[model samples]
Target: MRCDGGKPACQQCVRAKKSDGCEYDDGKGKTRTQIMREHIARLESRIKELESPEITTPPITLFDPHAASPYFSESSSSSSHDSPGTTISLSASASPAPFPIGATADLESAHWDGQWSSMHDFPAVPQIGEPFGAEDPPLELAQMLLEIFLPHRHQCGLELHVGRLRESLTHPLSEQRHPVLMNAIYLWACFLSRPGQLYEHEGLYLSRALAAVNDAIANPAKAVDFIQASCLLSVYFLSNGRLLEGSYHASAAASLALQWGLHQIGRDDFVGSMSSERESTFRLEPAKDSIEQGERILAFWQVFNLDRCWSVALQRPATIPDSKHPWTAITTPWPQRMEDYETGEVDIGPGSPTIHAFFIHQAQVSNAIGGFSTFALHAKAAALLEGASRLSSSWSPQLSTSPSLTDNFRAFEHTITRFTTSLLPLHQLSATMPEDKYSLILIHSLAHASMIRLHEPFLDDQVSRDVALRAARSVTVVAKHIADGDFDYLDPLIGHCWVCAARVLISELAQLQTTWPPANTVDIRGELSTLLFSMNKLSSRFPLLAYQATKVQKLLDAN
Candidate 1:
């Protein structure tokens, strides 16, 4: 059997009564036995020293709350006064710790069996008593939390370049830390911890991140980090059901993205390479390299995707201007995986528009060999769903529908139809990586959810009802896979989609009850149950989902 990497002893060995053999290296050449012997010797020496009773100094706390520690801080002086590559330095707690005692007592050994296994146990509740805010958690604990955060990174946004981030960690913390970004990451890491000590420290990190983000906004050097941190904070709030806070941060991120001209990253250059037809609308600094530039591009889309999708979910107007204004247009290329950026695979020459091009020309540039990736597809899916939702939200029987609006609706429906038809079947979606599977599932689910949202108002019409019914059923089918797979963390907005499907099923069930025989009532009830079950399971970790699941259950009960 494989060792679970449990501390002290692996459970497999302990349960088999071979705990004495469960040995480990202490990172040095010494084995566990050697380390134990040295610890005992040290304890004996400490006892002898205590027996002397000659100590005169009073004992002090291990970590001083008032002590200053080196940390990243923006210079208060004018930006122009600083050199081009000036690095900011500040001091705070060098050993800030959120390590609550007895926090890991309930954590199971098997939970570390694999990366996914560890992530599946979020909010595992190690039962913290009181928090010690004087010291920063050990770097080792931060690294451990980071390992847990990486696999679920996409749940927040795609602003991170994994290879670059991992590489940075190898350097000294003083050289690499961006307080705004690091604290934001630490907040997410704490939130994702499963029965780990950091969970209780989420508030501390959140406050630190928020304060740092405010500072970052004023410092031009920290703009990208500011945007990235805002996106993270937005998702963190939304996941915890703080809609107002989430929306505010999302709006801040989207607005700053426009200010930084992130949406037009390659546009000005791409256009300049071809015809100088377009001049830059926003003054922006050039990225140091493709990876830096690519992160900016991803940052825009991350904000765009979050603003668009969550706007629909929260029934609020989207914050990103998208194609609404010339300056606000998203002419940048579609986002790709960080690896593609590192490999220069996304350098598709100049003048090729991605998001806007896909909408206007139905250009399948994203489907092209090197251009296609799951994230690109997901971006398109978000755009399509948002477009359809906007149209649905505006449509009202009281307002006379214009031919232009009707045509727009038809165009949107046609685009959704084509988009969904092009997707791989659920069974055929890439299953090699679990993250890819999750993305594919969301892509398909969003497509179907769009149909329901678009047709929701006209559900009294037979054709619209039929369309919605089919889409709702399809949602259940895909959601069944999600439930069966036992995914704990998901995009919180997905719960809104689940609620949409449940509403359709509930309506169908209510109507079926009106029929004397109630034909196929069991099937409709079963489908609703499937969606509710999935939502409920996820609700254990996501309070937003719990709220959504409760409303759906009440709807079912009423029906």
Candidate 2:
């Protein structure tokens, strides 16, 4: 017998006179060319799969703005001001009137299509000096340095900071040795302290902060410090609109604080504990004033949960008041805690006082605004902040000077500006729907937008218009980021805020198209409607959005 390659077969096989070739010489091995061809075919298949259109659920398209309608119709009349046909010139010649009074008219005239490359102008990154002498300066100082040194570090800085924090957490400093430093580190990780450049970075910072706090907790000596750190981090998360994370941290911090009796510690010795036994054994003497302060911070974080589900008609499975698990108590008022404060005792009242105040104020405003929950929330938030300012000055002198305080105030101011700006558009929408229904929708949109815009201002009119136009285009973008499955990178609560803002924007854009002159009515309205439909589909989860999408659907159906 011979092998396939012409080599002699094994002697035993040859003796047997087997016709089949030896196993070793069967010639089953593939050539290099064949292997490469198979690889290329697999790669090509993969590329085609990547290039294929994603099989998404088709968007609902029930509205057609091009259909003929009587000018007297409610929808047509209400949106008259937005008609592209009625162009409102923004030139000096068009409106010679002075500043604030003519601001609206001026804004209208300046409006082009508002489409421009966003890369044209970006803010300069800030640079801060490194701290003197410390190998690992307090995290707070490090963050402050980052903010000061590279304020506009944007997404890059966020990534770097998260990396550094994660590394530090792996080898935490001795908890008993550096209370102040640890506190600073925890504060740095807080999401609110982060520069609001991109949503992704904010998420990274939040995750890192939570991880750091958890690491601290694992070390007994650092447990108390971790509590304070966690509480601050929770506040930061809530401020930045990461409600789920904020709630998680807030709940953890509040529980730990109660267990450790943090509110009982005297101002002078609060940061000195190291041993778990000693820390656990110490009982706080009730100090009503301090208790109120702690409560306020807690209350603020708690309100985020409520705000997250604000737009839903039916309560979500994860809503705040569901009794599946126990929740922290609502914070009590300051005046009620006066007895503990005057005596310098650790009263540490029922719950988070500051957050409670926020909710109370929100509820009051909601009741008064005739169901304009958003408006009432903002009005109340402003009031709560103003009240906080007064309380901080009286109860905690140092807090009044704290940079964190200043940051919070700035955030509050931004919130007010956003809410105030939304009033005009909301009022315009209210004219179309039933008074009560529209009022509720308008308030919700106003409050939600105001809250979000507080941090990221659209200072430039053109930029604002562009953002508004994008918002009008489709709710899909909003839904993808907000209501779509768990995107750990986004603050779920803040996502809701964005959804509300986008809804308002779409409504305003539609109104603008209708109110403009008849010259470009057909084209402009068509474009605006397409944009609006896209936005509507995206925000379909938030059915209570300011504009009556069902009305648009009916209009589409009629056509």
Candidate 3:
């Protein structure tokens, strides 16, 4: 019943359609709507100044020499040689900028602990013509933000090929560089660059992204970019603990994907009838090349991953339908890496019953598709977790006795066990990149969390408790690894898995308190501490994680 403190309107007010009543006392005595209106008014006045021929004053430069550069590029240091108010552009073929090389702080480095406040002191955004949305950002700023965003792209279901996107950046009006996607990327760049001046532009870029999204709805030609933008916006909201906004955008993305027949890519059979009316109107052809085709496939799966995993985390029904309805059945093959798309190594063949292949074909073998890469494994893990959560939620003492329900539950347990056991060792699976390692950790941890959820309701049964405990311990080990690493980015959903793991540990700790000398008390407490530490670290970026950490701490206090 508590407000999530979302901007413009809290989740409760949004749900009740009473956003007018949502107000915060920041000592300013203004509703969020009022504040937004005032900000819009100022921007509108600024817009008129840019448009008026009578106003010929030159724009002021807002750059600060002492602060981190507004632009990030390999040649950024060269910028100090330029005169004030000079404009710079980077070619897409320019050497890629090293991560956090010129920025004030890396995403997860020591500076993140407290130094980010200086980001506010850097400089105000140059307001001349609102460069971000009105015109494309300078190529250098665009490429820099893209680089900062790419590593964490998976966190928001982005499926664009890095090589292709970078290539498209050189072209001002490339479809790959659509306004919705660009604005969304700029918003994230601002968000992730917490110790740089770009962070100050988060609100500006977010508004532009939202505005572009609305414009995109009427332009079916930009449907793919719209879906990608929606996914990015969803994660932005979710990371800030705004579930209603997150879920709304998430559902929108999935709905658009389905509407465009992304789930049935390469399937000439079902495509004709899937959206006959819309097809006749727009006649949007399938992707023109393998790269575009691969994007469609990856986009569908990204939405699938988001819809499935997040629904479980939110304890809500999933947005994307598969197998439940003929019209919405997913026929897209499992996705390959962006590199595969660029090289034309993608599989464009029609999909077999997609989720079935993972649970049945892949689960039964240890070397299925060469042991499945981390990305593919992540999709499978999400499917298993969603399946377990959905099935378990519908269970009750009476339903548990139903043969069909019991059989389904046992089947999920079996599939998850075999699926997890078949996975390659974490060390072998992960690449040298920290982002790769973080992703590997998340999928494996999520798989274990699935087992925990499947057995959670049956904890009174000794067998169920044993299974759940082992899985919880596995998740705790992953949490420890995550806590010890210097990861610059982490998927916010990982915090939810940690919360589930913490609950099992809390139960064990409670039982241990009943006995003299409390067997394994130190070990349980250590694992619990590790989970809490990881959650708290993550909470620094995501408010929902802070809430979860607080609830767990209170449970520990009560114990």
Candidate 4:
């Protein structure tokens, strides 16, 4: 038979030969080749039918709600910034978690493999009965308590607990009487009070923490103690969202560390009685020591400098003027100074430092609020970040060759690059706000970063893996902390951490599913659901955030 496409079937050949259509002579069956030919012919006709341009489906419009909403809309703008006088209203109808008081602790234990870990776990707690008092609390313990207790105040509503935490800072704590612990408590109090509408309370705790650190610095014997105390306080400040305060503290800590080194030199000179040969050797010692001390001081400042820069970048106003702002003018450059090991000539790291990693984080926050301006900030940050990454390799040799040093430099470079490239598209979103709009800007940025990890040219590089893992872990740490609500006072940035954790978790899940398949997909959805629920709970504080929460819920549900 002739087909519609003008192809003749084998059956016509059989008929013309005066034989049966069936190729097989066996009783009731056609030969395999004959049956295959017919099947092939049917498939070819079906393929043609499918190949023809589809006409029945409606034309997709740029304005279609389903297709267009993700990319454009006005609702996203409102969620970005919290209005000046907005008060968070908690609905009586909202379901309260069982045992909310200890929820933060429980969540933390679950997240960290029940290690009771805290922010200060980096330098492990000193051995008991070795110099420092065995009973005296470790700085890590203080950090843990702050992280665990702070978020619990949210259960009492933002306004009430913010006041209460502020009040707690004034009362003297006799239990764990180390200067560091007290300062940490003060910092936590400041962090919790600042985020909402209470600026006065925030200042009080910050001032108190600073005072304690200053007092410790004045006493020579207590210098090391105070420096560590101050470092912890500053880190807490930065982590808690008191970026300006955090930056100040970080800078102060850097300066103090330098001063302490100088004081040590003075003490050494005062104590030494110089013989002719010893004096000759010692003359060179001061210069050599000064050089080494300077390098070490710069390295020390590098850590907090990054933190300050990141905080400033994140808090940078969404709007940009024709000319750069003064703060941006002074601080936007990367690696403030690059020290030459041999000659001590300082080269600056980069111009227009990439704020991509930082911006990606802010984008997540903006996405949670549905803020287009915030999203745009992220895009700008990403662009700068990209520029910074390109310039990063030039300073690679300036970084110490120590394994730890090299790894950190590589990680920093990789993180900025990956984060910036992923956020470039978010800049393209039109400036608009919609009613009842919510967007997972954080998740989207993270997803973009994760996509880069799975498919990009940098996948094989160790730095990429390190950056991706660190980013993921940072998110996880923030999420786990927020979920547990363990800190005594809540920082405004706690929500930022939650968003970070969610983004990272989702990114990791996506990566695992793609690369590891059946092995990693298990429990993935459950973990995602838990993170989404946490984001939703946190977002309920602001109406804009509530809308964002709803958006996240839908996104998670669809996924």
Candidate 5:
């Protein structure tokens, strides 16, 4: 057995009750850099030996360079070192290694067999779409998509100047807009687009958006445009049930936000391939305009919220921790309404509150906990869910419980109680509202769903069962309300929360089949069926909604 060469005695020696058998004279007393340099020196000497022309191994057969056919099946049994070769055929066990410095592919370790690999293994490059001008995709359809997008844009973190965007779409393109951002907008439009004509062009928009986005990733210098494009793309992916793609873009956005020094207010972080002169220009002049600076601030939190939400859904670590950037350096104020910016009501550097400032401020206060407005409540709900997810996943009993696990559970419940109680009478949503009940109901449903997630894992406990059952029932009721109403479009994030709620209900239902369910549990197969029907209907527009619907369907079938 080999020891890791621990100090005093090796692990093996320690286990065997030996006192002084360990030795690391070679590794001890050297810094990591010194050890790495020594290792590199040895590797360099080995590479030189292997790369020598005199060190010959298997002889490779050369495919005729002048051959008309692409197929190369002919092989010579034996060949000399100087034989001309076009392709390599190594042993199946041999790994693909990079060519040594100043060495040819066939310099060493090449075999001359005629075995073939399929060309289909390599995917063809995707083609980019033709440029979009005013006349490309019909005007009526573009306008409709923009309308479908605008009302929901702020919720998804769009801070682009709407007036400028409106002018570019309606009037001639006098000033150039960034292609990455332009295509990203077009992509989101395609996502929300309707009618046969609009829906058919999603492929066209996606290809164009992807082409520009790839280029932007290669050099994401202009942080504002890059952040917008990436965040929008991530939201689109998440809406469509493309979680991996969403996570990738979310990570990219977080990385770009940090790299751009958005975390550090008043600091210049030059990125990408800009010349020293251009970089120096940015360094000399920070964002003197408060509007631009505030956009960056809002943009940072937008990514932060996303990072927190999806981290729970995907059961992965969060990308942007709250402590990643201290609050002292990050002094960009919370976002106000986009209209406030257009009207020039809210100044950038903390002068006076805008029309929407109170809502933003209340939702974001550090010490306060409850009785916020509808929008502020929604933001807090998101935060609470994130906290619950992190705490819940931290501990699970492999065989039996421990003090740490029990303590974590208690602390987790305390947080849930605190947040749940914080919702004052004004904050409580009503199911009977006539005009616009869906948004508020969705918010409450999501908050309850969070309660379910935190308590669902420990449903055997009576307290946890009660909380989870209540949350599960609230989800079904809200879902039924939406279905009963004539709402055509559902927010994708709300769809995600409904899915979480359905999963909670379905889990309890599944439990009833085997173990003894809670005494208060009722047979709500009808409720489950209604919720499923609603989800199935919503799936036509929101593709990810189908995921929850299908899962519930399977559970019903199994039961």
Candidate 6:
């Protein structure tokens, strides 16, 4: 219709200038033109911020401007952007642009390489007042924090681009900086830090993060950082017993994920134009289009994982409803390492597998595990336990009176049994695949935990009591060893496992001679002591575990 000043290209030779870009007769300001203009304005602001010398202040110049600035290399004034002596600032070391418009640099860090550093090397995080502005934490401290969080990043659903993160923090502006996400990251770092480091700054970081998260939730179209920030905050809150708040943030992330079209593989609703080249124009930095795309995929998966896990953990319905979305039809591939995405090593072709493939079938029935080689069985097992937990949480006095629950438990029991039995043999899981051993530990322990969850409700039956108690003791011994060994950090699901195990042990102890029948009163007090001690070990880091431990202690004291 461009032939006669129209959009549909009508079959007529008319001298209608298409250069003005085909405005329709229906609307003027309410079109893609306006959306594109908004994007352009954001891009322009980003460019101006990077170019302007007075935009951010320097704390301790990490790198020379000539070497660091991606654009012009001229040295800018060193004066603080804020009122003199009132604020601190930082700058990105890799230059204003860390990548070419559509791609990232070769991100080579020791993290993904063969060599690994001990996470204990981070500087102690001292207490700070309300962290209101860009008083950037030291560059060394930031790198150390990044390192400390790396071992547990996969479990935490953190998928930030290391190269870009490093550059952005090196020169952080007040608004340009993703302070909320930064605070959340630091909160985790502080949590994992040496004993007292956590208590000192956790509140400060959390206060700032929560405030920003609230703003982002109110206006989700703000930026990609909000999604990741919300995901991290949700995890932090849940791990520390902030259930209601955590669920709110997690649900908010889910809403934003859908609104931003993060669920689809090639979604362009946010991008006004169809061209990748045109879309790249909105980018704030040079990190590739793939980096942004990968972030969206990873971020959405993070939210999805949270929805499933917490729905079970908290005994609530999931925000990401499986019945409504094309979740099964999602073709998005599993997330590669951030380094791989940054360096353009993303293998999304026939060779690479989709993350959703992990849920298609149970264990050996489908080759999704091997199909997605980077897949962690602990994460998979956690998801299955969540499913079982969801079923267990359905126990109402009315529902409990019905016989249908037995059939449901039986079906789920068979599924979990098959999954546990199908695991790789010990000989197969070697030093090379160290993660496999931990995965096996978690899967096996949680599988036993699943049996308890499914059967404990019907404990009046001798068979159900035996099954639940057997699984309870099994997980206790196995989980204690896992907590003390190979895995650097156990996810919060593991704490829930401990909670269930403690309940069974405490309930059995309550019955004493009647339950034992004066025949098998073997020294069970020692076992109870061991379980309580193990729970104590984790309580310092996870307050929910502390709460569970306290409940158990009170029970034992009462008896």
Tens digits of per-residue lDDT for model 6 on 368-467? 3222333334445655677677776677656435578767777778777776667664344432233435556656667777778777676767787878
- Most TM-score-accurate candidate: 1
Q: Regarding TM-score, does 2 or 5 come out ahead?
A: 5
**What is the per-residue lDDT of model 1 for residues 156-270, given as tens digits with 9 covering 90 to 100?**
7655687677666666644454667777887787676533444555656665576566567766656777888888888877776556677889999988888877776656544
| Per-candidate clashes, comma-separated | 8, 52, 0, 28, 0, 15
Q: Which of the two candidates, 5 or 6, achieves a greater lDDT against the reference?
A: 6
lDDT for 24 in candidate 6 is 39
Per-residue lDDT of candidate 3, residues 507-558 (tens digit): 9889888998767688888889998898878766555576567667767878
Regions more than 4 Å wrong, model 6: 1-135, 138-141, 160-164, 167-177, 194-199, 214-224, 263-294, 324-376, 393-407, 424-441, 483-488
lDDT of 5 by residue, 1-559 (tens): 3556676656775775442324344555764335544754454344333334256454222233313211111231122111222122211101111112123232222211101122121122232233222212344444544654654565465655666566666654323344466666766654554432333345455544554554455443446666777888787766655566678888988877766656444322311132233333222136545455556655766776577666666667877544422321333334443444445544233322211222233323421221233433454566667767776666576757778877867765665566555653323333222212444555666677678778867778888787888878877767765644334445566665666666667667777666654434355677777677877777666555655565557566766
Kindly state the number of residue pairs that clash in model 2: 52
| C-alpha positional error of residue 320 in candidate 4 after TM-score superposition, expressed in Å | 31
The lDDT of each candidate is 0.66, 0.34, 0.67, 0.35, 0.52, 0.55
lDDT by residue for model 4 over 184-281, one digit each (tens)?
55344333333322222233333334434544554554444454455555555444323445455555554554444421222232223432223222
lDDT ranking of the models? 3, 1, 6, 5, 4, 2
lDDT-best of 1 and 3: 3
Which numbered prediction scores highest in lDDT against the true structure?
3
Give the TM-score (vs. native) of candidate 6. 0.63
> C-alpha displacement of 62 in model 6, angstroms?
12
Question: Which ten-residue region of model 5 has the weakest summed lDDT?
Answer: 90-99
Q: What is the TM-score of each candidate against the true structure?
A: 0.75, 0.29, 0.73, 0.29, 0.61, 0.63
Off by over 4 Å in 3: 1-135, 174-176, 269-283, 362-371, 398-400, 427-433, 483-486
How far in Å is the alpha carbon of 130 misplaced in model 1? 10
| Poorly placed runs, candidate 1 (over 4 Å) | 1-136, 170-177, 269-282, 348-353, 365-371, 483-486
